[model samples]
Target: MQAALQAAGQGWHVFPLRPGSKRPALHGEQSCPRTGPCVNGHLKWEQRATTDPDRIRAAWSQAPFNVGIACGPSGLVVIDLDVPKNKSKGSSDAPDGATTFKALCERAGHAVPTTYRTRTASGGRHLYFTAPPGLHLTNTAGTIAELVDTRAWGGYVVAAGSITPTGTYESLSGLQTAVLPAWLRTILQPTPKASQAPATAVLGRSNRYADVALANETRAVASAPVGEREGTLLRAARALGRFVAWGDLPRHLVEQALQEAGQAAGLTAAECRSTLRSALNWSIAHNQTRRETA
Candidate 1:
């Protein structure tokens, strides 16, 4: 408990985990009543996690819970090195976690700096580093290598002093959180933003006219919330419009299907008609470009 408080004192947003486990120690049972699969509550720790001393005490006082570190709030990025227990069953040529991490550092031409390290109960390692400014890193599995994962924004890592059935998460003394490496920065960073157009779906000219793209667009339109009706309709129109330009679906048939989908998604008739016209115009322009290029 004191260790958790101390971690919070050092600017880590600490939360309670279930004793002897890595799951969050949330108070209430949260489930999706309609869909039967909860979306937001599955990661409630990210929302209710805090560094406040009082909240930390209140949480831990009820039970001897393990400490969980909310990485994003703490401005920390954690490299999780997991060694598989079933390594003997896998191919011998497959490199282990340590070997993969070492090879990565070798490629970067420098050893990883000694950082605030935590030896996880499962015999894995968690190397802590300061996140780079304006670099939004999300959680990824095997992005670096097999058995290796990262916990960044929207993720949590069990903290040092947390004990579980496997073992205890113990700190490696005499180390500080180091700056993220330039090589790692390149790999872990978010992709640069580009144009807002949705990725084009490849079309084929086979006699099998299944209209799979239209079916997908219809589903998207139906599932979209009221606020997204306009954008969803526009995207659906553009996609179906492409098929029209490719001489796959007839223009009138495509327009009718789009109009039906837009109306089902709660768009006004006027809005649907106007968006349909614009999309057909876009398709006309697309065909014109193709002709000019040819």
Candidate 2:
């Protein structure tokens, strides 16, 4: 409880978790055990999570619950390094978990920055880092490497000092969270400009309007909610693809933006490519139909 208060003091939004469990201490119709029907009891703790001391006090006062820190609002991203309780074989010599993490760092050509590391109850590790601006990194598994996962926006991580049946989340002494590395950023949160079209092509005034439209649509896709991301990506693709149909923007540029936006929303590169192809085809057909009608 004291740890939770301290986290709130440090400006990290916090909420209570069921004791020794990672589940938020939420109440709902399905959650209640009483014979009476649940009344105004479904708690959306993720949305209601706050830094207010009085609320924190009231919450922890009820029971010795664990602390859960909301990652996005706190501007934090956590890389969860989970070791298998049972060992698994790979690549004749490759090991999963922390060993895989080491290999990943080596492959990236840099050491994992010294940061706030927490040892989890199951002997896993959580490395906390400040999130990059405007990029909402989501939970990923096996994307970085085997047995490695990440927690970011729309997610939460158990904070240090929380105790579970397995063990406690203990912080390693003498380390602070570090800024995310540029190379890591490239893998985790790539930008649309990485594959930008060359400047050699002279743009006519008609094309200039398309350029502005693409820029706005790109921003909208980037900022869309996770639940809405796929639709947003399709919409952006159709809009930009319309410009491509009209020869206002290069087809490659529209395709690139859709690829970047799709990946940002956790789609595989191949998935993005496939979706872009379908969306572009629909857009071209729709535009042709409109032109014929006109």
Candidate 3:
């Protein structure tokens, strides 16, 4: 009960999870009693999660339930850095989420921003950030990088004090949550449909250099060998991002062209967006510096 109250005190909506488990304790829609909280209709875990102290106290008093924080209501975007499931398998070379996220930060010329964080039972970490105002971000899995998932709207995370069969979730960094980084926000933002209009109509006929670079890079990505496709996509995005930075090409145009090429090459939409966004962010940031120096 104290665990739930503590979470609620932080303005995070809390719900009960089954004791010694991560699953929500709330009755599901199929089993809705249609009474009390569900008198009118079924309320899913997200809807039922509340910051009300009385409700929390009442709920937790019944059992030693774990606490779950509703990310959307709390205005949080949590980056979940998870470990590999089987290190002994042929996946020994697979990088963990933390490593991938760190590499991503280095690519973008930034460090991992210090913020409120929690350590999960499975030896993973949850880095919490405040969601940008007026944007309804949803959950993402393996989109930012392998084993890196995010919980936002439509998702909940186990609170710091929660415990499960594997281990306990504990607060790692008690620091205040940082606002979601702009570069990451760009990546997480939903991609609009590709434009059907000709590129020359948008960028003007004089940008031949950028036009050629875009075409060559995207074509390379499309024709890249299966094993090398991701690397090819990353390199292509980084190379073309300079054009976007120099204002020779629109960012959306670059994104759209590369996105189509990536999809054509059999890369998942999420994978393409993640790779493109990260690579472009890095190239744009550095290219701006190069331009200033030149």
Tell me the whole-model lDDT of each prediction, alpha carbons only: 0.71, 0.71, 0.82
Screening candidate 3 with a backbone cut-off below 3 angstroms (N, C-alpha, C), the clashing residue pairs are: none
Ranking by TM-score: 3, 1, 2
All models, RMSD in angstroms: 16.9, 11.2, 11.4
The digit string of per-residue lDDT tens for model 3 on 1-294 reads 887898888889999999999999999999999999899999999999999999988888899999999999999999999989986355767788899988767654468889999999988899999998898999988656778899999999999988898899999877488999876776566532223222344455436767888898899889876545666677788778877876788999999999999889888898789889977887787677323221
TM-score of predicted model 3?
0.69
The list of candidate 3 runs beyond 4 A from truth reads: 88-93, 194-294
TM-score of each: 0.60, 0.59, 0.69
Better by lDDT, candidate 3 or 2: 3
Clashes of 3: 0
Point out where model 2 deviates above 4 Å. Answer: 29-43, 88-94, 190-294
Give each model's clash number.
Answer: 0, 0, 0
* CA lDDT, candidate 1, residue 39: 48
lDDT of 1 by residue, 141-221 (tens): 765556778999899999888998879999986447887876576556543221222234234522123276667777877
Task: Compute the lDDT of residue 260 as modeled in candidate 2.
Answer: 87
